[model samples]
Every structure is written in C-alpha cells, then in structure tokens.
Target: MPDGGPVIVGISRSTEKIREIVRKVADVDLNVLISGESGVGKELVARSLHYFSSRKKRPFIKVNCAALPGELIETELFGYEKGAFTGADKQKMGKFEAAADGSIFLDEIGEIPMSMQAKLLQVLQDQKFPRIGGHKEIDARARVIAATNRNLEAEILSGNFREDLYFRINTISIVVPPLRERPEDVEPLVYYFLDRLSKEHRLPKPDISPRLMKLLKGYHWPGNVRELENYLKRLLVLGESKELEAELEAAGDGWNSETDTASSQEAVIEEAAKEVLPNKNSREKQFPSLKEVRDKAVYRVERALIKQVLEETNWNRREAAKILKISYRALLYKLKDMNLTPH
Candidate 1:
C-alpha cells in the first residue's frame, strides 16, 4: 500500500524524490539511515516511515544517543539480566526489546561509542542481540531507523566510528533537506508556529505584517525548522517588535547577538575572537594532516567561544550581532549556518 500520510508542507522534485523513496521503503525491514544537518526534521521523516509501514500500530521508541552516558548506552538499548551492573537490581528490557514488534528510532546515532557500534552492527545483520549480562540471545525483530547529523563516513575515516556499522545502518539512506533548501515551506511554518505558539503562550495571535514575512524568507535558516519554531514561540511571549526584527537578522545568516543599544560591541568581539582562536599551545602547535580534524578542532574553539560570549551577553542576540560587526539579522544567519546555539 502507498503512504497515506499528509503531504509534507512543501512540494518540489527534491521532496517528491524523498516521498518516492519512502513509498518504496515503507514495507521493507531494512535498517535505514536518516541523514541531515541539525534541526532539519529527520525525526519527522522517521515517524512518517513508521506510520506508513506495516507496523504502524506498534511502538515507536526513540533513543537519543547523545542524551545518555557512553558507558550505559549498550545496556539501555540491549537490556541486561538482574544484577547486570551497579544499578541493575532487577532484569531490564532495553529499548530494542521494548519495541520488539514495532519500530525503534535512534536519534543522533553517530554519537554512539565505537565499541558499541559493533554490537549494533551484529543486531542489524543477524536480527538478534544478547542481554548485557544474560546467557541467551533474544529475538531482536524490531525495525531500526537511525538518524544522525554528523557525517559518519568522516567519522569512519577518523577511526572514531566503525565502517562495518556504517554500512549496516546505512543500508537505506534518506537525506532531509535543510530549511534554506525549501523556502516554499517557510510561510506555512510561520503560520503554523505562530498560531500554536500563541495558544501555548496564552497570547493573542500575532499579525505578521507582509513586510516581516519578506524579511524572513530573505534570510537563510541555519538552525533549520527548530530555530524558526523557537523564535516564533518567543515572539508570542515577549510580543516585542525587536524579536521579530532580530529573527529577520537571524534569517540573513548573520551571528549578531546584540538586543539593545546598551550592548557592547567591542567587548563581545574581543571575547568571541579569543574563544574561537584559543591559544591551544599559547605558542605554536603542529596541526593535523586531516582536514576533518582541523575543521573539527576549529569548530571546537568556535563553539566554545560562541557559547561563552552568548552567556556573558545574556543572549541579547541583537547586541551580540552588533559586537560581531554584522547586522543583527546577519548574526542570526551565521549562528544557524554554523549549526550553533546563539548567545
């Protein structure tokens, strides 16, 4: 049977191609890898797959790999016998077992440790996984849909991820388009969030002047849908015109954090610069040969600096934007572009 789900908000060859693939894959028990940058709604695609699949009525369990400690993820997923470890006073059913006849969604799958990747691989290949401290292999028949924002191929190359596990989970891959790639969806999303946020905040629905709509579409959404949704929710609460203006600047792909006249541009910039280009050596340090390593390291310093500056400025995005010497709108764009949280 074809997917009877609602048509996704926007329509285009790209989105249609995705729909086409889902229609084909919905009935199969393949291990699917849903890939995209942060906030691109990979989880939406996963839910759609489960709803349209043969097991629609079964459980849809979500496991956020990044939300747990690396030491405990395996037991969390594969279960353990009574007394498996320090806290295992009783036998436990892990995520895989809990969703036995349904589907399991593993979000941020790339965050799984290298050692555990092999266990996941065995489960995918053989349809079986043993309890952490138990003797017998249990029937692990649930369909697996895993999502990740990181490039696992890069992780594999860096030896931080397993190649075999990548091949296993990536048996079928679906890449969700970023918000910037689908401008047609913006208006609908704004309307959707505005109304819902208004209701949630117990406020009157906002009248987004046509001018504001234009400004929003003109900006690039680096944080994807989540950023847009969050911004609109804040608007319903604050009801400040500046929130709308700040969102416009954010859409412009800038990293401005200044929210008022009192914001100190010089102070924000000096702190931001130091945070991003930290004196790792306080002298000279030999750089790595791999571009990914270098990029990851640069991103490391950049993220740390951004986080610190945002904290110091109390998340006054407009002022932070001014400090960065970019339009407040531009700063919003860059923060999203960097897939980073703003200060």
Candidate 2:
C-alpha cells in the first residue's frame, strides 16, 4: 500500500482481506475485477487501487457503463471526431483519453451491451482503439478496473456475456461480502457515518442508544452500506428513535425468514402500515383515508423490497421470483402494479 492507508472502511475480516489483496496488487498493472452487490463500495476499492499505485498523480477517471445508453457507449468510451455523428459539434475526448497514464474505473461493467463488448475486449487486449469516424488508433495508457453486481459466469453460460472478455478482465478478482454477512462491522460503520454526516452538516454528533444500535445490527440491510448511511442520516435529521423503532417493527422479521408465504407477506405489510402511519382524522381531519395510507405504505415497502432482491440477483427476474417465493407471473404483476421497471 501507499504512504496513506486504505480508503476502505470497516474492521471485519472480509474487509481486511480485501485490503491485503489491494496492497499486494496495487503496484502491479494487471486488470482487476471487483464483484459485489450494489452500494457495497466497489468504486471506493477501485479508487484505493489507483491512489496507492505509482499512477496516483495521474488522472483517475470513472465511467458508469450502466448509465450510458447502448447507442452512445462506444462513442463515450472511444471519443468521436467533429463530424462523426448527426450532432457532432466539436471534438470530444472519451474516458480512455482522459485517463491517460492513470486509471479508469468502469462501474456496472456487465450492463454493457453485446454490440460493444468486442470493441471493449480489443482495447483490453491491444491497449489501443480508433475513435469513431477516425482511422488513427489511440493508445490506451490507463489501467482498467471493472466492477459489476452480476455473475459473469451465469451470463456467459446464457450467452449474454462474452467468455473471452470475462477472462481478460478477471486477471485478479475481489468479492466484497454483503453487510448482513459481517455483523462485526455494523457499529464501526454507524459511527463512521455519524461522524461524516455530522461534520458535513455542522451538527453535533448525537449518541446512539443501545436499543437503536441493536435494531440496526439485527436488520438485514438489503441495500447494503448505502441504505444504512441513508437511514442514519434520516435518524440524525429527524432526531427520533421512536419513529425508527416503529418502522422497523412494522417491517417485521420476514426479511430473514426463509418460509415467507403470500399471506404472511401481506400480513407483515399490513402490520407495518398500522405501526408506521398515523390513523386518519388524527391531525384535524386533513389526512387521507386509512385504506389509502396503508395502500401507499405497502406500495413503497413492496417496491423497495422487490428492487433490492432484483439487484441482489443481478436483475434476473426468474431468480428473484424464486428467492421472493412468488410465482413468475405474480412478480411480473406486482412490478407492473407498482409501475416499477428495470433500468
């Protein structure tokens, strides 16, 4: 590792092991693949690799492969000439060019479309690619670090991903375990978030009650660290432990239950709504009906849970259905009912 310590936070064995691997490979220029669920800080690990390496002084550019549309990904990665496309106003430099002699972090690499996979493979193999509408090949001097929540092996077996490209990027792989799997890091992360949020917001650091801490540790964070951070910020802003407790109680223990049936899921949602929402006419008769409020709460909770499971399964609806213990048709119906579509 470099003079400064690792950028990753946490004292869990899994996190420490990841740091050990990073230290061993930081100086070497081999391509790296990081696999983890969404919001598990894959980008942070990628940054640590670049910062601790010899190329710390150079540019550290990042590209979100999932954010760009399929039609524009190639041009975004390889740049374009002034007259390359319909609206080519001026010369544009892509991520590879901006990251010269440094590192380029490709987040959500599995989302890249099949049409552009071969081009990306060429750049990985040859370290050079021609810009759109330009014959001259540009040298790729940056180290490539790719991360994805998807299982590329399954994708390859299904023919959704290229096998050769998988080998090229899997030179060194790091798997970041989920937060629920490592309970020891929960308290450290809570304090870390509290300190950071307090400093940023210029607020005094509030002490966490043992009860709150216990509930936090007990809950299965489907959204991982990002979700925990958001929840902490909410707690700080609201300054109400009772509200947090009520919501958690309403959410129930179905999150960890392996035998969650349809009726049980519905009952859990109803119980959560009653606990979290105030009864109608409690606030001088300006509130929505109790049924409407319950419906809304149930919708929000269901949407969140479904979305979390989808992310955990890498957007594989069939797999998600199996985990959720719902039929494929029912899952599709619920998605449509909630107006939730995969990005």
Candidate 3:
C-alpha cells in the first residue's frame, strides 16, 4: 500500500478489470458489494471505490460487523442516546452519521446477525434511521460498500441472511480473485511489501535473493496478500534465515499434506534438506551439531504451539499468554523473536 492511494498493486487482467469497475461505478451513488477470500484485499477495492467517488473528501467510515455482537453493532452503526445503555455517558454519532455524504464500508457484512439485517435493510431502503433510544431520525446518506468472504447467496438460502438486504447492498459486485489465481501479482506485491515494511521498520531494504523469490512464487499462499505481506515483514527483520525458510516449508507442507502419501512426505523433506544441506559430493560437507539440531527442533515446536494458542485466542496476547501459561512479557519476546505477527 502506497502512502495515500488505493492498495491495488497488480497489473494482472483481473486487477485491471477491477480498476475498470471502480472507475465506472464510483460516484454513481449505487451500493456496491465486494466479494473475495479472506486477505484477498476486498477492503482495498472498497477504498478504491470510495477514493474515486465524489464523496472522497468526507469521512470514509469502516465498520467490521463481525468484530462486535448484534446489540453492539446496532448501537455502533446507529448510535445510542445518552443514558440509553449502562455505560452511555454521551450521545455520540454512529458510523452512518459519521460517514454522512461519504462512504461506509461494512466489512464482513455476512457476519451481521439476521435481526440486525432487517433494520439495515429498512435504513437502506428509507435512507433514514433513528438513533437507538431516540425518536429523531437521521438521514442515512452514506454510500454503502459491503465486503464478504462467504457465499452470501448460500447464506440467504440457509436463512442466516436476509435476501432483501443482500439485494439492496449488492447493486454492483466486484470479486477479487485469490493470489494463486493471479500469480503475476505476487512479484509486485513482494516488492511493494518489502519497500513498505522496510520504511515502516526504518531498516534499509535488503536485496531479495532469487532463491527466496522463487520460493515465494512457488509456494501456495492460502492466506493471500496479507500472508505474503507478513512474510515480507519477517524477511525484513530476519533477512531470510534458516528458521524462516523452515517455517515457509512447513506451512507449504501443511497446506498440501492433506492428501500426501508417506513417500511424498519423504520427498518434501528431501527437497527441503537439499536446500539447506551442502552437496553430497562436496568434501567440505558440514553437519549441524547435536545442540544446533536440538535448538532448531525446540524452536519449531514452540513456534507452532504459540501460533496455535494465539489464533485460538483471536490474537489477544494477554489471553494467549494465560492459555499458554507464559508471562505476557515472555510471550511478547517470543513473538518478536519468531517474527510471529497477526495476519
């Protein structure tokens, strides 16, 4: 992501098609729905739409409905009157009001509860909504741009989502393909992340090795652009260490090992070993010491356990530390050492 511009960085056909859509539909005052796999940059597309729109000067409010409960989401979107809730100390404007005459991006819109969907639909249809516990109705003037990774049509069929609300928000749809579908995008993304992360870390950008680039392009990134970005951040910090290579190989193996046979597993290990090990015919072949092997094994196991605990706790470091029976400071140190950042 460049400094003040939309994060669409690829020149692939799919990416070009997205640019075309943004150019045509932006400023049209029609609601748009962006669909894609997680981390495929759906929010980037939404921002691009908002950026090119007539309301670019106004606030571009973003709401992640999935991050809050149903009751809280309603209050967050429509606001609540002072003293309406137990903690209500002031009458604050909600996201819709904050986005007045601009764009409101509803991320993870599929995760919105069904009951709230009806209220959302009513607001969208009427272009007005009252704050919670208030009789005065405020104009809903924001352009709605919703993004979802789920199959919303399937969700509607299953009665988890309102069909009317889906139709209301999805006047035009933009689907961002996963990175694996557009591998050409990976190169630019790598360079972009490298430059961006290097600047953020205040580190000189290290030259990316051809072998590392090859590994990056060849590996199937199930986590999409976000995953690639995190790996590049790691590279910036770690400078392509053996541990990083092992982690990448392990992640790739796990992704593909669902149907792998015993022989295939051995083949993967052999290939990984070849990458690290000296040529067999070399007279100066060196082997890792017993302590070195032990340390590496411990590091891998610890990293996996810590990662699993972090994910299970939704990356809440304090909760993860409690679950892992480690001190918060210790966990933070491990995370920094392992370059284990949240995705």
lDDT of each: 0.79, 0.86, 0.87
Better by TM-score, candidate 3 or 2: 2
Which residue pairs clash in candidate 2?
none
lDDT of 1 at 320: 75
217-282: candidate 3 lDDT, tens digit per residue:
767788999999988887788775878777776766666555354555455455545555456798
Q: Best candidate per TM-score, number?
A: 2
Higher-lDDT candidate among 1 and 2? 2
- What TM-score does candidate 2 reach? 0.73
TM-score of each: 0.69, 0.73, 0.72
The candidates, ranked best first by lDDT, are 3, 2, 1
lDDT of 2 by residue, 8-37 (tens): 778999999999999899879999999999
